[model samples]
Target: MKDKYDVVVVGAGPAGSITAMYAARGGCSVLLMEKDRDIGMPVRCGEAVGKDGLNGVIEIRPEWIAATINRFRLVAPDGAVVEPDIGGTGYVLERRVFDYDLAMAAVEAGADVVTKAYVNGLWKESVNGQERIVGVTYTWKGIPRKVRGAVIVGADGVESRVGKWAGIDTTTDFRDMECCAQMTLAGVHMEENACEFHFGSRWAPQGYLWVFPKRHGMVNVGVGISGMAAKTRKPMYILEEFIKERFPRAGVLTTVAGGVPCVDTLREIVKNNVVLVGDAARQVNPVSGGGIAGAMQAGKIAGEVIAGAVASGDMAELEDYPRRWEKLRGARNRTYYRMKKAVFNLSDETLNSIASSVLKLPREKQTIWGVFRTALVKRPSLILEMARTFGLKERE
Candidate 1:
């Protein structure tokens, strides 16, 4: 809207909105742009968020939630099952509403927010023999426009052209990408207050399948398969087949397909005067492929760091973005990456064995940590890393 601002954030998803909101609240001029006509149209997520994780970054609103979850059902190949208290609240969000509200929050915080504003490229200039991004070029409401800023934030999703333009390598390894497909179904019979996870080659080879309640009698059923596994079968086909077998009479209401970066945080997130956040920075949980909560947290950190840099007129302060992020989640995500590798190698029989063992315990003793501990029965050292990362004792 304006020709210039203190911060220009691309992709008005959770990360961009949060970054813009905080930066504006911190007294920096901020612009949040969304390429799509609607701020949160065509949702591309599982739409599930852990209570503590979401509340840590933003307040929870009942209107933005679809279902409240406090427990999880885990199903192994042999159909052995265990239901564990997720330890806190969980919510399947009405993402479109959630995203729109977040963007409005940014606007209320004094950031200019716009939709249908396609950012085509970055405005880069050379300084001291090195190129740096100073702003962005976009088509706002079908009119070509350019805006300048002291710092740029790329909250673009999996296909991050802004990061590419800023010379921040945003590519995820083929093997580390998860090809995902999800469909919201009506008239499905499942626990309304619980989320379910299914595992095995027959269900979701090289990845996991999830069933999350959206509303009473309605659920979002999805499957994420490793990029390697996708080479053999389509994720959507797998999902459809499972739906026919599991919820034969249910009606498909909506379908979504996308990729999730199942890798550790990028080695570099901030470069020069630009920083990458959310899916652009590969901030999703390496083990679960969940990015909503991580994106919010990363956005908050980036906003504060960029605001300080703007206040002092010292671009060098931008470097604190990555350092602060590392302290918050980067280190723990690396541990999750290793855990992903270890879990991926486990055989179907092994998973069933673990599930059986977990089921044998008293209902209350069959906890999420107990399941994690069973997976690391061989690599006890990795258990230490897991314990430290999760703030749980190894014995738990």
Candidate 2:
């Protein structure tokens, strides 16, 4: 749209939109681009986000929410159920409306927004014998256009090429990747205020299956399996079998498929004039594969950092983006990664045995804390990994 701007954000997802909003609020010309013709089209997420996860970042709007969850049940392979005291902490969102509203907020804050803009390459400017990311070349409406900027934020999804172009390693271990498939179905009988998660190798191989209520009779049923297992078992067939067994009468209204990077955050999120946020930075939770909240949080940090750098007339200030983010949540994220890797390595029978032990406890002991404590009793060596999961030192 313009020859140049102070900041050009690629991918107008939550991370990109939030980055644009904050950067513009901090006194910078920002342009947000989306490859899709409409923002939030073809929703690929399970759409369940916890209330505490989004507390300070975004005020929950009534319209953006489809269903509110008060509790959740964790079902083991033997059908042993453990209900966690979540206390109405989660909500299923209408992502199409939610994402559009987020981008609109960015526009209202003085950032330019464009859809159907596909970024094919980055614009590099060399200085002192080093090439730096300066801008991007994108196709808008079947026409090639070039836009230059002092800073570029790659808010693109998991298959992001921006970071790769900037020489940042965005590689993920296949075992750390979750191949996911989701379906929005109607005529399902389920607890309206509770989400259900089923676990076991039979249920989802190395991952899990979730049934999040969208409304009273509608639900988002999904499964996430390890990418390594996906090589042998097709995700769609697995999902179909699970659905048929659980909800034979359910009619599928919509189906979506995607991949979630269930690994620690990328070590380097910013390089020179370029920054990566959200999935591009692998900010999804290693344990749950949840990323909406983390993406927004990282976007907020990246926006402020980029804006501060622009105001200070120092390009080097962008390097602090990842540092500030890690200080805020990355440290805990790394811990989760460690725990995820350890638990993921556990045999399915081991997990089921652990679940059975927890289920035998009283209703009061069915909490996540209780489950972990029970697990520690069986495998004392996992204590350190569990400590790391909570950001606690092993010595403590």
Tens-place lDDT digits, model 2, residues 1-396: 678899999999899999999999999999999999999888889999988777777677999988888888888777877888878778989898999999998999999999999999998778689876678998999899889989989899988888988889998888788999999999987788888998878878888899999875989899999999899997788899989998999999999998999988998998878899999999998889999999999998899989999999898898888888888889888888888866766666667788888878888878888887877886776776666655676563
lDDT of 2: 0.88
In the range 1-396, model 1's lDDT, one tens digit per residue, is 788999999999999999998899889999898999888889888899877677667788889999888899999999988899975478899998999999999999999987888999998788799876779998977799889989999999898888788777888888889999999899987778889999999888879999999876889899998999999999999999999999999999899999999999888898888889999999999898899999999999899889999999998998888998898889989888877876765679878988988887788888898887776774565567656655565563
Report the error of model 2 at residue 212, Å: 0.6
Each prediction's total of clashing residue pairs, residues at least 3 apart in sequence or on different chains, is 0, 0
Q: State TM-scores per candidate.
A: 0.93, 0.94
Residue pairs of candidate 2 with colliding backbone atoms: none
Off by over 4 Å in 2: 126-130, 384-396
How displaced is residue 219 in candidate 1, in Å?
Answer: 0.7
Candidate 1 global lDDT: 0.88
